[model samples]
Target: MKPARFFTPENLQIVKRLVSRYPPGQERASLVPLLDLAQRQHGTWIPPSAMQEIGNTTNLSFEQVFAIVLAYPTSFQWRPCAPQLRICDSWMCCQKAKQRDNGIFEAAQSIASQYGVEVKTTSCLGACYGAPAFWFNDKIHTDATKETIKEIISKEFT
Candidate 1:
């Protein structure tokens, strides 16, 4: 709640570089980078107070951070029990492998839920070549199958 007080020298350097990227009066354009740094430092979603700190650093106000928070999906607070899974359910994946695509979703949910991990579906992970892909945290799984999905969740979550 108190902005975590966990700022590291590396984070400061990153934010400083980001701020320097914009023109003199347009430092606010660094909102994306600042939010990214906040998320990386916080190890999850950006807390509201952290957003305020971002505002302080970027010469913006908390209200501005609030607006950006809603605009960016990455800034939202992670839901309860969610493993933060982002499955690709795009048309290309569905066209190439609908059965496996559907199976991957079901398998991930079922297996992950057993370990209290939440499974989420997304339209695309931008890996069309894989036909079916998913992102678990920062890791990517390509051409995922139901059995593979189960194994992945089992190994990662439990």
Candidate 2:
């Protein structure tokens, strides 16, 4: 991870306000918001130096800050694609994947590649019934078919 390039004075004030929200001895609670501030200020990505600064600002060690960053799905040390698409890749979705993904991918491939939209798989999205599910624009899409997935691609990139 690179050092964050934009932790300006204004961002520091925001971090102070965010940390102040937590009561004494619970400054760790402020890590998420402060990381969010770091991402926003540094250009939609968090950096190791931002983590270090966060640790220093909150009295946490570098390892402690790193653990939280790794544990949180929304926090990333690098940039994400313009539209990150995550499909369920669990055993539960195995059959559904066979039934649907080929066409969905065919329908989605051109647009996804052209727009730099990412279509990848995850272990689960938490619901077995929604096997073959995916996340688009932060919304879970379950039992998705080629048409539905295409709609998402079209709406987002076309």
Clash count (model 2, backbone only):
0
Query: Residue by residue across 1-158, what tens digits does model 1's lDDT show?
Result: 55454457888888889899989889899988788778778777888878877888778999988888888675355433355677877987767667544667777777777877667777778898887888885677888887777787778755
**Across residues 8-45, which tens digit of lDDT does each residue of candidate 2 receive?**
98888788889899899899889888887887777766
Model 1, global lDDT: 0.76
lDDT assessment of candidate 2: 0.76
On TM-score, the leading prediction is: 1
Error of 2 at 13 (Å): 9.0
